[model samples]
Target: MASVIIIGGGIIGLSSALYLSEAGHQVTILEKGDLSDNCSFGNAGMIVPSHFIPLAAPGMVQQGIKWMFDSKSPFFVRPSLNPDLFSWGIKFLKKANAAHVEESAVPLRDISLLSKKLYEELHQRGEFDFGLVEKGILMFYKTQKAAEEEAHLAEKGKSLGLDMEVLSRDACKSLQPELELDVLGAVHYRCDAHVYPNQLIKGLVSLLEKNCVRIARNHEVSRIETSAGKIASVAAAGERFSADHYIIAGGSWSPAVARLAGLRIPLLPGKGYSFMAKEPEGRMKIPALLAEARVAITPMNGSIRYGGTMEIDRINTRVNLNRVRGIVEAIPKYFPDLHPEMPAEKDIWFGFRPSSPDGLPYIGRSKKLSNLVIATGHGMMGLSLGPATGKLVSQIVSEQQPEIPLSAFSPDRY
Candidate 1:
């Protein structure tokens, strides 16, 4: 069995460790932070199969441009002098076509569905107690135009065999009797699910530890030594770790690690904000996306999590109160009685999503580095796609055929 080293201790790295160890390989995971925190913690806790569409779709360029300057906007692209950002933006604009989106939709949907199933399998093994609820997701919208547009997307989802239903304002109210939804309509996807990220991490960590998977936390990988297009060793934390294979999943900071092996990955950090609250008096069973406001609310564990905002600028971990306010203001609009009274900073949380312009994650070995695998740039779908990604990585490391096509998500596709 090959000895593998996984860099990045987030969900992707931990999940890869789980899959590799289960496959009989000796695995070591290197995390730069305390293995307990990251963007994965404060996510909407969604296993989102309904997110079949890539971010760089038709009309997105226009929308992004319009919202670029607004600090409180759900999406913001801070213009930078960085050449990589420019190239990625240009390529993103080119790929923003209906055809590309349609072509990509199937793969995105399939991987997410596979992940949700894998999550179910893990849950059934009855190893840990993470809140895994397959209560479906509702995309609630305020305007007729918004609802109609989303309904069209929901129809597409239904065609893909996902259980999707377009509900009117009244029908939405029926599904969510607790929340007084102020919306025109909703698109509900029953195939989706939710999970508390910390719980999953805890369970997975225990499982990995039980199986003897080595996890090195609070350390950074400084360099990768290569010979004849193959990785020789990864120098990190005053030691040299040589492995038969390596999976780079450092999340938003992935580019730093990839560069050590001479790979030029155009990965950017898209910062997001989130906070937790007691479940409003009339808590709903299903996790729902507030479409018009672009916020996501999930009944995680027992409490609710309010997460949204895609700020594409400012690399540091600074939490912006204005952006946090935007998400807070949105909560009351949907659940009228819900109040987020805590100081934005106290309840504030920010994490960067390693974003690639085309909305597809880079998930294959680079031609330049024979033994190194690139697995970052997942953007917002990291949690939803973690299992499938780990499975694919295991297959690739075993010299087995990939479970899905890799061309669509190649690191050099750009």
Candidate 2:
């Protein structure tokens, strides 16, 4: 049995550890910070099969250029002189086309479906309760143009065997009678679902610990030692960690971690913010995405979460008040009845999503390193794709065929 060392204690690492241990491998997870919080936490918690389209799609460049002027825009790219940022931007611009979208749609759908199924399987096992709700998601659009676009996508989803429907204003209101929605229509994606990310992590951590997986919290990976084109060991928390196989699932910090192994994985940290508030007097039953505002609203077990903003910037934890204000302003526009008080700046939770230029995850063994597997660049779908990614890594380590095609998500693609 191979001894596996996984970097990052976030959802991806934890999920990989679960599957690896189940496969009869000794797994060790090294996390830089406390396992309680990461990008996995403070997310919208939506398991999105509805999100088949990649971020780098046609007309995105034009939209991004327009949004650059608005500080409160949901998608903002901070201009920088950083060489990595410039390089990544160039790559992103090149791939922001119809071909990339068409190429990415199937793979993204496959992974989301696999992860959604895995979540159901985990729920049936009754090992842990993480508030796994399969109520699906509503993509509400305010304008007729947006509604038509979504309807087109819904047709595409239907062709792909996804259960989708274009819901009129009345139908949407019927599904979510609690909220007063002022929208033209909505696209209901029945394949999508929601979960409580915090609870999911806690349950997974508990399960990993119970299964004898060594989890080293606060152990920051600093250096990777390599010999003969293979990893020898990794230095973290002032000590060296060696294992039979190594997996890098460090989320936004993946590129930096890969540099230690003399490899370059182009990844940008796209910061997203979310905050939970007490459920409104009449909370919406289903999770909904305010398409025009680019905000995600999910009603969890106890509280409701409002999450949005894809600020592509350097890695930092500073909270942008304008972005938070934008989210607060968006709520009343979408749900007229819900008037939530603006949360304090300190209460706002922000995390970086490892965004690839092409908007597909990096999941495969490195071409240069035989014993190392690189898995990151999941972007906004990290929570949705975590379990499927973990299962794929396990299959790779075991020399078994992956459940889906990995050509689109190859770490060495770029």
C-alpha lDDT values of all predictions: 0.85, 0.92
lDDT tens digits, residues 108-160, model 2?
Answer: 99999999999999999999999898989999999988988999999999988
Tens digits of per-residue lDDT, candidate 1, 324-389, equal 788888877877767776554766777899899889998988888888888888999999889888
Task: Give the range of the ten consecutive residues with the poorest summed lDDT in model 2.
Answer: 276-285
TM agreement with the true structure for every prediction = 0.97, 0.99
TM-score of 2: 0.99
State which candidate has the highest TM-score.
2
What TM-score does model 1 achieve against the real structure?
Answer: 0.97
Backbone N/Cα/C clashes per model: 0, 0
